[model samples]
Each structure stands twice: as structure tokens, then as C-alpha cells.
Target: MKRLLILAALLPFTALAAPLNVDNNPNQPGYEIPSQQRMQSRMLNQQQQNKGMLNQQLKVQTQQQQQHLQNQMNNNQQRIQQTQPGMLNTPSTKPVAPRNGDMLKQY
Candidate 1:
């Protein structure tokens, strides 16, 4: 009867010990499962970094295009002013004289 009692007490311990051995097997080859929340957070961080870089590139491109257009507009305005300075300042109302001696009278 004493042996039976001792065996009964040790049976529960053996059952618990078996699971511990299986849990602690470091050399067992298997897929490492990352927790779902950790994977989601990592993916979100990567996406945000990509978006930030893209936004910075776009901003720089837009600034460069605007500067180019402004320079072109300034150069065109300068050329126009040099070509016709009086045209911009005064409106002429005189009728131009004909080169030939024939005059057409407008009554």
C-alpha cells in the first residue's frame, strides 16, 4: 500500500515534466511564429518611412519646377520690355501714312 501511494504521487509529477521537456527543446527545427501584433507594427513602421521619403522627394521636385517656371517667366518679361518699351507705356491713335502717293479719303 505504501508503494502504491508513492507511485500515485510521482505519476502526476511525471506527466507535468514531460510537457516541460517538449517546451524547452531549443534544437527543434520549426517555423518561428512572430506575434500578430508585432508583425503589424513592423509593417506599419516600414510603410510610414516609405511614405515620408516619397513625400520629401515630391516636395523637392515641385520646388524645382516652380523655380524653373518663374525664371522662364522673368526672362520672357525682360525680353518683351526690351523689344517694345513705348508699346507698353502709350496707346497711339494716329493713322499711318501710305508709302505710295495714292491717298484714300475716309469721310
Candidate 2:
């Protein structure tokens, strides 16, 4: 019983005397030593900034692609409109002349 009491007192003293080494060197690469809350906040900020830039780039690229496709479609439509009359107005009822007498006989 006495040894148990002594050990219990020593245990509390050991707990109180424990050292807390919490210093982190900022100059070290890939050394993540921040508190949980600070680390989360920093990660969220970085993610937001990256997402913002990515969204901006995606928007610009989408707009450029849409404009390019629209221009191509307009050009194709204009060309089709310009060529439609020529195709539709050509005479299609004429019989083709045979190149040889044998072909004419077969027809």
C-alpha cells in the first residue's frame, strides 16, 4: 500500500514535468507542423485560390471554344447557302451519252 501511494505521487509529478517540444522550423521543405485548425484554414485558402484560378481558366477556354465553333458553323452555313442555288438549278433530266456503241446497245 505504501509503494502504491508513492508510485501514484511520482506519476503525477512525471506527468507535470513532461516537456512539450512544439517548435517547427519554417525553412524546412515539406515539414507540416501546424496545428489542426491552422493547417485546415491554410489548406482551405490554397484550395480556394487554386479552384478560382482553374474556374477562370476554364471559363475563358470555354468561351473561346464556343466562339470558334460558332464561327465555323456560321462559315459552313454561309458556304452552303452560297452553293445551294447552283446545285439545285443544274439540269438533271438529260440522258448521258454513251462512250461506245456497245454500251449504248446494253442500255
Candidate 3:
């Protein structure tokens, strides 16, 4: 029948016109969803910014550590040199005096 044909034709469009579901979650209030492109761009930008900040921090920390290590090494060298440079390196320093116990002849 022509009426049946018309009803069938309109049914598909009726389903399309139905309201979209929202606020399905009960625990939380409604939340906004940004467009896919905008969210992706924001995520990428934040990631890069965080990575850059971390990289700078790491670079500064590493440089400070390297300088600290270099200073420590320089201090150690200075201490070594100050303590006994000629005795260890140059032969001109007098030999260490023999201990009295070692002078006794072994049986």
C-alpha cells in the first residue's frame, strides 16, 4: 500500500533524528570533549614543551655535575701534589729513613 511505503520511507529518518545520548556517567558531571584535531595538537604541544623543559633541566644538571666532578678531581690532584709531589714523582728527594727494628739482623 502507498501508506505503508510512505511509513517505511520515514522510519529510517526518524531513527536519524533521535536525540544523542549525553550525561551517561552518574558519578561525575558532564565533561566537554574537544575536537580530535584540537586535542591531538594540544597533547603534542604539551608533550614537546614538557620534553624541552626536562631536557633543559637535565642539561643544566649534567653540566653542574660535570663541573662539580672536575672541581673534585682538581682538588684531589692539588691535595696529592701538596702532600708529596717530589717523593712520588721526582727522584731528587731523600730516601725514607730506615726503621730501627729493620736494622737488626735476622737469625
Instruction: TM-score each candidate.
Output: 0.48, 0.52, 0.48
Task: Score candidate 1 by TM-score against the native.
Answer: 0.48
Candidate 1 per-residue C-alpha lDDT over 17-101 given as tens digits, one digit per residue, 9 for 90 to 100: 9888774565667633457658988999999999999999999999999999999999999989876857665576899777665
lDDT of 2 by residue, 1-107 (tens): 99999999899777765543223555657557568769899999999999999999999999999999999999999888977987665567888776766464554
Residue-level lDDT of model 3, residues 58-105, one tens digit each, is: 999999999999999999999898768465664565778999887988
Candidate 2 residue pairs in clash (backbone atoms < 3 Å) = none
Predicted structure 3, TM vs. truth: 0.48
Using TM-score as the measure, name the better of candidate 1 and candidate 2.
2
Q: Pick the candidate with the highest lDDT.
A: 1
The prediction achieving the highest TM-score against the true structure is: 2
Q: Rate the local accuracy (lDDT) of all candidates.
A: 0.85, 0.81, 0.81
Task: Indicate the residue-level lDDT of 97 in model 3.
Answer: 93
